[model samples]
Target: MKKAWIIWLASTLLLAAALHVAFMFAYPYILMNAAMDRLSANGERENVWTHAPRMTETARLIVRPSPDLAYSSCVYDLSDGPVQISVQPWGDYMSLSLFGANTDNYFTLNDRRMPESGAIVILRTADQAITDEQRAAAFEVVDSPSARGIALVRRLAPSPERFAEAEAARVQEECRALNAE
Candidate 1:
């Protein structure tokens, strides 16, 4: 009888311990599954950050010295290819960027001339046929051996005016393309 009681008590304790462990593991999973199900049920909602619709981020143009003309001109581009703009991820505004290609050295807009507080550096669309004057006046020299890009910071969000339907569609299309791949 005494042996039977000890065994029974031990079994009860073991069962209780197992139940505790099981609850610890299963409770969160159930909660997460339910949460995900709820979110999926409401997946049709659309907003600015929603993934289903398209969005455009920004448009960049390349600037280069023009062979025929004496000034640099920006060739407007639709950004059909993947373009990467590199900038330090700190601060409220963009100070430097590596225009079209990463191999192109990073340029700081405030290269030698100081920019007023809110001036934006614009690069032309094409890589060739830019005039020296356009290169000098239209685009800011972000990086040079001379003074530039020292205080330039990064801007994660552009001005509201920069957002457009075409840009949003491109972003959405890119996301869809990436998801398909």
Candidate 2:
């Protein structure tokens, strides 16, 4: 009876371990897909920035969104080619962050680190090639572990008045296919 009970306990632990590992691997992908779907629900195309209104109590598009920050997001799909992202600085604090499909934040650039002209980044898949022209351009090139990911911009807007300035800065932000032109 003692041996049988020990075996049962071991089996239960193994099953629990397997389940935990599975959930860890799957949750991020599931969450990211849902976020993408919600972001594009309005017939918005990929590689285009969608500006979100100031965060209110009803805002639920993102988990734990900051009420003091304005957000703009782009669901990037790089299967066809590279995408170009431009962010204009606004307020005292602004940041651009890139997240992989698995919810890993692989890149982040803040306004303090950005040039006075703003930030221009080219995001491409690992297999994609960068042309000589792109390499020579002033923009920085980054590699995406997955073809699909999210680019998010956050600008500090502590008040309703500052939120309007954040919105104006978001208007100058751009996310588009590099080859579109």
User: Could you tell me every candidate's TM-score relative to the true structure?
Assistant: 0.28, 0.88
Q: For model 1, how does the per-residue alpha-carbon lDDT over 1-181 read when each residue is reduced to its tens digit?
A: 9999999999999999999999987775555334323323333311112121112333111123222211111111213321112121222323343222212234544322434433334332343233455345432422222111111122223444332322332232111110112
**Alpha carbon lDDT of each predicted model:** 0.30, 0.89
Report each candidate's C-alpha RMSD, comma-separated, in the order given.
Answer: 19.0, 2.4
Using lDDT as the measure, the top candidate is 2
| Error in Å for residue 15 of model 2 | 5.1
- Write down the worst ten-residue block by lDDT for model 1: 172-181
Worst 10 residues of 2 by lDDT: 36-45
Best by TM-score: 2
